[model samples]
Target chain A: MKQRHYKYIVPILLGTLFSCQKSSNNEDFNQIVEANPIETEVDVSSEIAMQVIEQMPSPLEISAIIKKTGLSYNSGILNPITHMENYTTNSQKAINFGIYATDLGYVNMYNSSQDAMNYLETVSSLSQDLNVSHFFNFELLQKLATNEQNLDSLMHISTQNFEEINDYLAKSQRGDLGALIIAGGWIEGMYLACEVHQKSDHKSLREKIGDQKVSLSSLISLMNAYKSNPDVELINKDLMKLQNIFNKIQVKEHTRESKVIEEDGIPMYQDKKVLTVMVTDDEINQIRTLVIDLRNRLVK
Target chain B: MTLKRLFISCFMLNSFIMSSECNLEEFSKNAAQKLAGYTYLKTYKLDASKEAEIEYSYVFSNNTQYVLTLAHELETTDILVSIYDNNRKELCNNYDKKGKKYFQGIGYSCSATGIYYVMFSFKNAKNKCGASVLGFKK
Candidate 1:
């Protein structure tokens, strides 16, 4: 009887051990699945499609332009005369000159060629031609242009100029005009950041800009208060439209890669993809509604 | 007696397995939600030796593609941006080396809508980058 009991006890112990091992394995599997999970795909709708089409800069027109003239690098070129007029009438020409002169320095740094440097020098001279003051001086421009062959010097000069400008902006109160100029400077800084990122993968423009993170929406709201008072309706309208666009494009997920995995008998997905272009119908309609609202407000 | 013990053990094991599976699914959903809601910005110190930085403001409307002013100009380090919905569903993740504009979709079936948090950071900076958020209410 004792021998029989011992045999039964051994089998029972072995069974318990097996059960514990199996459960532990199951838990491990579950943990893996949790770490690597899958996301459900959203269904894109037709209304969203229509809205997207409406907002797109007629692809046909873009394609036609491309087909007709290949690619035109002059799309972003500002009409110098008109731009200058806007610069002066909207506010002080000196500030505008200073801003553009600084921009030229950045443009020159990236190009780092005799021709590019010459072009920037011309731009710098043009700013002086407008009789813009030293308060808005292109000291940074001179430094960048003279040190065309040195990337480190160029970066240091640009950074210093930006610091000075930021200090000026902080101390001076020029209403909306100053804000607009700063906003433009931000874009120029972004341009330089992008150049830096491209030349070296060790730094990213986004990261640089990220450090100076400002709420674009909030800035627009502040500008909106001055809208009717200044009657800069057209500019206000454009800015509002821009604000809407910014809203649509800013999404979480910093990178553009995604992955999917499976654990045990279950499958899961891990999304690492950054900057996906696919937009759902709901997203499109939302943007359309916002645009229409901005247009209506501007028209009123 | 043996049959009774086997039955009890089977029941307990089934319950434990079921609970473990459910817990994992819940965790994934939570993670997705966190990713969707995350947002941050960064700014870098301007190199004074170069030109004064240009100021720019950007807005994305109706699938419009606006070029990042730095494209072809500045050397960029790390760039990462992702889009997600209110429910935490991952929409898009885009990394740009050339400072290219990432086009937001306008009207499309299955396009995502709503407020998206665009979180971004640079490799070597301690500051945050600022970005404007714009969208229409559905």
Candidate 2:
């Protein structure tokens, strides 16, 4: 009876050991499979896939387009959309404005030159084409070449462009239309001043471009000197108005857009918000003062 | 018997743990050094004028044979290039032409190694230009 009992227990223990070994091997195989990186082959629909690929942005091509636009603008073959209207507006507004302003400093400046007045009268008929205020400045510069009386007014007008530009810049963020317009006017003013300096051999006018810095006060001073007639009280009054406006400007920073994200913490490209901007109120008073100063210098 | 088996198993496990710990320090040290040495360089502008002299220095490894480069949109109407050895002895001067415009030519001998200088001189020019340099090593 004892032998029979031992034999049964030994067989049962052997069977249990074999079963445990099999379960351990199965667990090990499962763990190895789980640890390996799995790659799934997705069978994309050719028609849909091709359409999606075509719609993706090509960075190289986009950059090339932007470069071409810049080149065209630089070459003057294509007037930038930002200033196209200014080129077409009444040319006389510029001539009249320039001559009248300059006369305030030196009455002799416009004595023999009715050329600017004539040009202004001609341009007034086409005022609809002018896009920005600087277009008027350009005409004024052209008239100033013949009419010396336009110098003080030209200075007042050009200086106002700078003040208005700074105001616009203060109110808007970088890359905005306001910034582009301001840059356009600044370039126009600088270009005119450079041309005049080259033609007349004016050392002071030439020096204006040398520093490469643009400020309201500096521009006002430049205009004051270029007027060249100390007897003119109107020029002095305009300069003071410019100073008052520049002192009151203030700027504020703000975020204009926010990004959208996916539920899994990944950013969604289509929902990306770009462009940060800051606005200020201090420059507006300067702009108003500049405009008033320019008008006062020109109307008289 | 049970105590002896348990002790042997613990001893084997301890040995495995200690060996892995030793390798971890070496791997981390190498990673830290590599991260510390990396850097970035950017070029903003390069200008050459008739009034201003151009100064340049270059180096080559033992196997380097030849170097070729191109300069475009030069501010000067004419460009002249001169190469010199470490002792300041003149090596060669070459004139490069593209259509009606002339540029600076760049070339070197294979047997030369160490530091060499190339000077570029120009006259009456304007606008921004680009330069591309290509070198061969043995």
Candidate 3:
């Protein structure tokens, strides 16, 4: 048994030795690992596999896609800022915090400074209620929201702040709350996408909605990690329903080597494969109806 | 020498068995500025487990030009990144094998939407503190 231990451990020691020699950033390994925010005892269950929610596209991605369509801004489509007070529980606060962040993103995308400021204040309030306000720079964000030229910075900072809050929550024992934030943000993004689609019936937007199948399964798996919580369990049940509808959409995939081109000394690859997303009008309607209904139920 | 090896064996056992994390207080913002002309979407702090590579999956939409900007406390772009399509097909890498050069990021424009797995590793197994930020423009 002792000889076996040496055989496996020697190689790791040599690897560490080489790593330490080449390491330019000489951080004290033990101290740094001790201070890592991801050191929390995660309660993520193991039944569901591929549980990675951290890299899911920002809730703002759908908003960015919607804004590029030249659709007119509609404040009525957003969750009302006045409803921020109704969420008293930690779960409610975290979820609404995410919803308000997405709403704030939409407001920023349209360059509505006044509306952005309102959403910013409300998001800050909710983040405060959730004890995550330290992750946000409310004054700087408010200042940026007032200037239309700062729209990009405002959007980036808002998204980054929400990411920080989620990270902090994950570091503590509240990773379930982080999952809830993602769930809320994702549902609101879909709701906004569906509502915008209802307005114009954009063909590309429909495909984009269908393309969300990739993240949908991962989000569902992530939610299942925290299914022990009542809020997470209920949300996961609804997400599974969404997943079922998404499962019905057909996507044919093929792959080939991308044509690589050099841009400013960087490699930019143009993917050759194109997938035709086959989502019928009926499926779209089902997804849209369910998204709107689910979002409304959560917020109301 | 035998005692030293024994101590290292025990230490390695502890590290390999436990979860690895990094101390990246402000990882993303520091790198986002480098990749201008693109709107920041998502950022990931790399776990500093040198023995293992970090893999993150993101759903990238086609027709949108996306860039994955990498930053490190090492102050060099020598960090290794390999991007794979949803099918785990190799798409592109930051290393220039011909020129022996390393770029700071990978730019990808796909014609189809799928989950792309971005893997980041350090060349010398020295990946304790670094991050990757994903930015896009349609």
Candidate 4:
């Protein structure tokens, strides 16, 4: 009886020791990320894809252009800040975050601090939900939102944060979400431009809308990389519809004259190609309608 | 159980790993200061290779004023920024016609609506990591 009891106790002790050893090994493996990480084979295509995505212009530029037109703030055109709860999925949250960010930039351009706060709150909540809030400086943003006089600082900080967030997401292997954020922002921007065009006749603004044809094509090609994602595929389908309208807008390019000019005693090289957008009012109307429909689908 | 303890310990250690190695935040903040009065547009990290030229393809709306600035860890290396048109023709490099190659930035008044490429590389030594920022004015 004594020998049998000893045998049972020994086996039990051995089992617990082995379990502890295995756990320790697992912990060590996890800690390797902090140590000198082993460099994995670089995926050139994926790297190129991220580079292209990051290369896309910030929507704030478009919003600033819109502001330059002296248009009044149309809160109805923006996605409601209260719709924070509506974005339940990761994809929806990411896309709406982009929409709200563009809206925030627009509001900042107009010096609408009160409206900016609401949009900022919605954006912060979404960022937190997506676990990318670390990249955003909420405190600084809040301070800027309250102080409308510092509009330039607000714009700079907001744009920089978004780029950082995109970088972090791409580095973390979430490039698909980064692509969606860009797609969402670009669509919202084009929608805003088209809406403004619908209301007023600004030739530059119209040209800006037509010029987005190039951006839209680039965005679609980027989306194609992540077409395996159902969410991305659906967005591509909607954009393709918009693309069909964009295809009708013709852009004629002229030969670039390369020259160097002296400005302020500094030699400035000029090698610019002039492109004329030949888009009619009817096509503009089509773009406006389709953009509104697509934006509605996204925000809804 | 020991497994539970191990999981917890691993998570704690993983947090340390996530703290960041390059401190891009501090670098970006410093870069933002250089772009004063101009609304920031985008920031990029410079690859640590002199021979590795990275081209960023973007669209500059017609008649827009834009500027691009490059920042680097001065103790380690320097960066060169350049811009090109859709036809891949060199528009301007930070190195001016007066033989100034150390300038870390360039400004372009975009007069056309088309794709533009902003390329970056190191100047002296290779593998000099840095950051670049873009801003625009109306």
TM-score for chain A, candidates 1 onward in order: 0.40, 0.23, 0.82, 0.80
lDDT of 4 by residue, B1-138 (tens): 899999999998887655424555566667666775567887766554433566676777777767676666665566667787766667778775457445656777776766787877776743356677777777
Model 2 lDDT per residue over A2-116, tens place: 0000000111343443111112111222232222232111111222122111211111111122222222212221112233234322222332322222221122122334433
Tens digit of lDDT per residue, candidate 3, span A152-181? Answer: 899988888887777677666677888889
Kindly report which residue pairs in candidate 3 clash with one another: none
Report the Cα interface RMSD of each model, rounded to 1 decimal.
Answer: 18.1, 28.2, 3.8, 9.6
The TM-scores, one per candidate, come to 0.33, 0.22, 0.79, 0.78
- All candidates: CA RMSD in angstroms? 25.7, 33.7, 11.9, 15.0
- DockQ, model 4, C-alpha based: 0.23
User: Best lDDT goes to which candidate?
Assistant: 3
**TM-score-better candidate, 1 vs 2:** 1
lDDT of each: 0.32, 0.32, 0.74, 0.72
- Tens digits of lDDT, candidate 3, B1-138: 999999999999889654234546456667777667788887767765544566666778766788888777554326778888766778788998888867778899867876787887776544366778888877
Worst 10 residues of 2 chain A by lDDT: A1-10
What fraction of the reference interface contacts is present in each model, in order? 0.00, 0.00, 0.60, 0.48
For model 2 chain B, give the 10-residue run with minimal summed lDDT: B35-44
Docking class of 4: incorrect
Model 3: lDDT equals: 0.74
